[model samples]
Target: MGFLTKNKFTLYGVAAILLWSCLVALLRDVSELFSPIGGAAAMYTVSAVFLILVMGLPKLKGFSKRYLVIGTLLFVFYEVCLALSIGMANNRHQAMEMAVINYLWPTLTILLTIIVGRKKVSLWVYPSMFVAFLGVAWCIAGDAGISVNTLANNFADNPATYLMALAAAFIWAIYCVVTQKLSNGKNAITLFFTVTAVSLWIQFAISNEAALTFSINSSITLLLAGVVVGSGYALWNQAIIGGNLMLLGTLSYFTPVFSTVISALYLSVSLSVSFYQGVVLVTLGSLVCYFVTRDKPQKYNVKVTT
Candidate 1:
């Protein structure tokens, strides 16, 4: 209670993290119910409505032109890539794999911070990155274990989904870095999400997907997903703008584990032993990255102009 009273933004960040952990599973289900682009369109449409009802319209005044233009573009693109990557997976099981890939953002975020912020880091950075990438490869390798052949084959089989998921990882990393630097205490999350919804709808309109036939359960899932997605972003925008990014990054280290567990259970799927092994490696890599730079001072300046 006392901590919450003092550090409410941090709590919001934690809440956002928890909500986002459920994202992969919900997205898979939603995509199963509606087609990929159509379901994503519907979910973000509900997200836009949910945010408007709760957060009111976005105020665009007083934002840095850089933040406005770059932040909006990055946020919108990241959200689209995130939705499409998982939603387009070949199967529910593959969707779970995509969750692992998307979580590469945590490590990438730290890595980008170290490089872009020009912060000094330990030699561990190299090994940490290797372990992280290796984890992804190993995860896709499944029972075959990590190998160049298996890893390449895995991606070859689903080039579009895998490429989108990988792009989402890097895009999100850049977004986290850029948004924190230029937010100026203002969050255009409502605007960004609204744009994302529109973008998704446009994609859906052009695609042949019929939005599938929604059952009662799927409809309920979509509503719940919309609520989670909307509130999660609203809270996350607050969090990244105010809370400790390093601490949040540290906490995010566990996202893949949480996501895999939730996704497997929610989707009623099984994962191979290697997949779990890869998850651990990926998490440990980020943990190591966190350790290397935990004591470094925040280089980027933040303000609450709003």
Candidate 2:
């Protein structure tokens, strides 16, 4: 059973990474039809429709009002911020510069858990956090070459992209914390639908500037995005449930690695020397967090019964 679970989670991690890569690649294509806002709107709109059809109105209506409202609003903001980040970065190099910045979240999440959940951090936690922090600093310094230029050249420039990425990370952290608190044994499917619907409405409201014309490519990409979100979340939930989160988080570093590769292949993105350096820091630092942090749940006994 243990071996089977491990193998399954290993596959889940790989699948999650791949799906994210595809989603990122698709975003580049979709960005052409509408601004990041429009693309996000389209994505959630499609997701909403998909959920209504598959899950039906009655089941979707069964969710708690709190879940319906908070989950949707949080994720909507996350998507919008994410799109803005991508728009600002524009290129893989620039986008990744901002992206590596967000590697801070996993490390910071421990401290956040400490503060919000009032969980005590183990002694080993600090060392890992420090290592991860230094790693993030290294990544920032290495990528500072591009970030500085972008910031200096245009204030309205891709600074928003980096800011958006940071915002997304922060919002995601909050969402994680809140979801754990609120979603005890809740129906993930219903929660997903509510979030999608609410987020779509938000996106549509904000995306007045978006082009309405749906090209064949954009439509195809939109469909792919919906499928990826729907399927990928299911698989990722399984992974977290079955595998050790510490180990899985360590493995999940491969997401950006896969993103870089996919960008290179499809988007014609070239890797910079500094980018590779950032990769090393992100990979190694995440591993440090995994190893140094206690993996066993007995220490804290966080009763996230959902």
Candidate 3:
């Protein structure tokens, strides 16, 4: 009991991972009920409403409208790309592929920190990132029967899907770097509300389907995704504040692995050997990057907002 109390940060970190892992599977279910845009709209709307009820109206006195608007736009971009990456996929396997590909954001964030912020990183970080991306290539190639031609064909056929996934990664990397200069705490709540409102309107304008669909599974999943996953951000923030940032960052590499496993179990999807190989290489590369950076004097401390 005493030990558990002492290591609460570890628990928070684990909870964050569990909550984040469930997001992909939950979103996949929600996507079945709504279009990609519609699903994002519903999730963010629910999340915003739930947050408002819990936190009351966000205090906006000190925050400038420009900053708030920029923050909101960033959130919108991230969510849309994220939704398209998953919702646009034809199946759970493809969704996991996009999801793992989106996981590249963390590494992108690192690189951006080095370039944009002029932060110095260890030399080994570059090779580690290379190895990690090789894992992604292996997974994708493996999915196409390890044939280069098939891999090229797959990308050519589903250019939008692959592009959206990559865009999600790039957008998130920018968001992490940009948000650091903006607000945290209550301001984050405000950003959530703004994103929710804007996304709902955009969804309505673009989607032909009616707003809101009631189903047992989808409703439950929305609750988990909107409330549970939404709240998990706070848990993650706590973990980041209390725990070793490098360790937490390293552990986050497991999110794609967990997402893949959860999706496979829940959706009864079969994972290919290449998928496993990719997961191993990606996870290994991320760990290597973290370890190499761990001893550096100036570490990239960008917060994971989603």
| TM-score winner | 1
lDDT by residue (1-306, candidate 3, tens digit) is 997877788678878787778777777777777667677677777777776765567667767676677777877777777777788787777888888788787777777867886767789889889978887777777756656797787788678888988888888888777776766433565356556657666766876766666788777777767887666665665676566666666677777777778878977888888898897877777777766655452444635533
Top-scoring candidate (lDDT): 1
lDDT of each: 0.81, 0.59, 0.73
Off by over 4 Å in 2: 1-13, 51-68, 117-156, 187-210, 238-249, 295-306
What clash pairs does model 1 have?
A: none
By lDDT rank, best first, the candidates go 1, 3, 2
lDDT by residue for model 1 over 57-176, one digit each (tens)? 877876888998998898778778878889888888788778788878878887888889796778998899889988988888889876788888888888999988888889888888
Question: Candidate 3 local accuracy as lDDT?
Answer: 0.73
Over 243-270, each residue of candidate 2 has an lDDT whose tens digit, in order, gives: 5554455556556566666766876767
Q: After superposition, how far is residue 71 of candidate 2 from its true place, in Å?
A: 3.4
The 10-residue segment with the lowest total lDDT in model 1? 297-306
Model 3 clashing residue pairs (backbone): none
Model 1 vs truth, CA RMSD: 3.4
Model 3, which residues run further than 4 Å from truth? 62-67, 143-148, 184-190, 210-212, 294-302
Cand. 2 TM to true fold: 0.76
